[model samples]
Target: MKLFQKLTPKALIFWTIGDQAGKVYLGILGNLILIFAIFEPAKINYARVLINS
Candidate 1:
C-alpha cells in the first residue's frame, strides 16, 4: 500500500542510522513496541476505511 511504501524508506533510514549509532537493540525494541501499539490499530482502521470506500 501507499502508506507502507512511504514508510519503508523512512524506516530503512532510521534503522541504518540506529545501527551505525550502536543503538540497534534499543531501536528494534522501540520499533516493535511502536508497531504493536500504534501501527496495528492504524492498519486496522486503514483496512476498514478501504473496505468501506
Candidate 2:
C-alpha cells in the first residue's frame, strides 16, 4: 500500500547502486583514461553509477 510505495524508491536506489558498483567504477575509469589518453584529462579513479533498473 502506501508504505510499499514510500519505500520503493529507496529500495530501488539501494539495489541499483549495489548491483552496478563495478560497472560504474569501470565506466568512470574508462572515461578518465580516455580523456587522459586523448585530451590530457585529469587522473581520476573510482565512481558510483546510479542505476534505476
Candidate 3:
C-alpha cells in the first residue's frame, strides 16, 4: 500500500505494535473499569486503575 511504502521496516513494526496495542487496551481497560465499578469498596473514594509496576 502507498501509506505502508512510506514507513521503513522497523518503523512499520513499531507502528503495527502501537496500532494493535491501542485497540486492545481499550477493551481490557473497559472491562477493568466495569469490574472496579461493580466490586470496588464503598469506603475508598479514589481511582481504581490497576497499575502493574
Count clashes in each candidate, considering only residues at least 3 apart in sequence or on different chains.
0, 0, 0
Which stretches of candidate 3 lie above 4 Å from their native place? 40-53
lDDT of candidate 3 over 1-53, digit per residue (tens): 88878999999999999999998999899999998897777424334333322
Deviation in angstroms for 25 in model 3? 1.8
**Using lDDT as the measure, which candidate wins?**
1
TM-score of 2: 0.39
Q: Could you estimate the TM-score for every candidate?
A: 0.38, 0.39, 0.51
Kindly list the per-residue Cα lDDT of model 1 for residues 1-53, writing each as its tens digit: 77666777779798778777777677888999988998899999999999999
Candidate structures ordered by TM-score, highest first: 3, 2, 1
lDDT of each: 0.85, 0.70, 0.81
The number of residue pairs in model 3 that clash at the backbone is 0
lDDT accuracy of residue 25 in candidate 3? 99
Query: Which should have the higher TM-score, number 2 or number 3?
Result: 3
lDDT of 2: 0.70
List the RMSD of every prediction in angstroms. 16.7, 16.5, 9.8
What is candidate 1's CA lDDT for residue 10? Answer: 75
Candidate 2, residue 38: lDDT:
71
